[model samples]
Target: MPGERTKYAWRSHILAERALVGAAEHAREAAELATAIEPLAGADDVVCAYVPIRGEPGDLRMLDALCVRNATVLLPVTGEPGPLSWARYEGPDSLRKARFGLLEPTTATLPPDTVATATTVLVPALAVDLRGVRLGRGAGYYDRTLGAVGDGTRLIAVVRDNELVDRLPEEPHDRRMGWAVTPGGGLRELGHELPVSPE
Candidate 1:
């Protein structure tokens, strides 16, 4: 319960910071994030990725890049709070507004276990620490859904360059990210030491 309070405080602080990002800056970062994500795209890769909402670091360009490379992309379909179901991403036209202001695919839904098929899963995060701890929006969607990922699946947290911090609070139910991709930093492995400027 103590950690929950800390987690909520962290979420509030990070979200307030995200809210101040200007449109031009956000667009530039989105473009850079797309470039960082492009290298991971492959024709045979099945990627589980999310659409950016609020002031999240990435945009549709990231998904478009993966599609351009012919990778099969799956987006999360919201339902009752539990493991997230999925749906195939056919392109921009295939998406429709869903619960929580999320853009979900309109295609046939896939079971929660479908995430096991992904080669990589890019998740949205408010911040990620050197130890791979990811800070979400206090919703347990990712924490619950990620449990279904198969071994060897790359669990990557997508955040802005500055959002990568030196440390974050970790709860027992929190799944650790193996990697993080930032607009300016590209992709970096987690659970290792990285020089971080003092806050």
Candidate 2:
């Protein structure tokens, strides 16, 4: 139970810390993050992003911002316990309740490999250390999805300002993120020891 214990311990600690974030403050931070990420979207570019659920840092406003920038935003469609399938984000009107209390696009689903076409991938994280080791929810969905991205893709971890930490528990199969975007800090490049390899 060591792995489970470690994972839960970190999860519990961070979630409790996040509980202090008031709804108003959360919305403000989410707005800041939306502004920060807008510049990352390019016209005619495909970007992979997620819709934030309750208690998550950024909200759907970020995705809407990407859409306004003319980027083809891809949202994850949960499936079997492997890499996540993607769906193009049509708009807020196109979202529906999905498994695990997630809001997913009702648009046609794309194959899991569709992530390869993304130029930037914004991932959800509880915390991301300076080394770019992202501490995710124990489900491992982002871990699997990120592993399949093209070598040139920019993997960015989205966390609250204080969630950018000095360190976190890591394993061999763990994938490192290249950047951490915080509500206050904007986009920060991490000094991870191991660079992400497409192999």
Q: Which candidate is the best by lDDT?
A: 1
Per-residue lDDT of candidate 2, residues 1-199 (tens digit): 1324465688888899888889999999999999999999878789999998858898989999999999999999998899999999988999999999999999999999999999999988998888888889888887787778876889999999988877778888788999999999999999655555697
> What lDDT would candidate 1 get against the real structure?
0.91
| Model 1 worst lDDT run, 10 consecutive residues | 1-10
- Native-to-model Cα distance after best TM-score fit, residue 137 in candidate 1, in Å: 0.8
How much lDDT does each candidate structure score? 0.91, 0.89
TM-score of 2: 0.92
Q: List candidate 1 stretches off by more than 4 Å.
A: 1-5, 193-199
- Estimate the TM-score of every prediction: 0.93, 0.92
Model 2 RMSD, rounded to 1 decimal: 5.2
Q: On a 0 to 100 scale, what is the lDDT of residue 110 in model 2?
A: 96
Give the Å shift of residue 18 in candidate 1: 0.5
Best by TM-score: 1
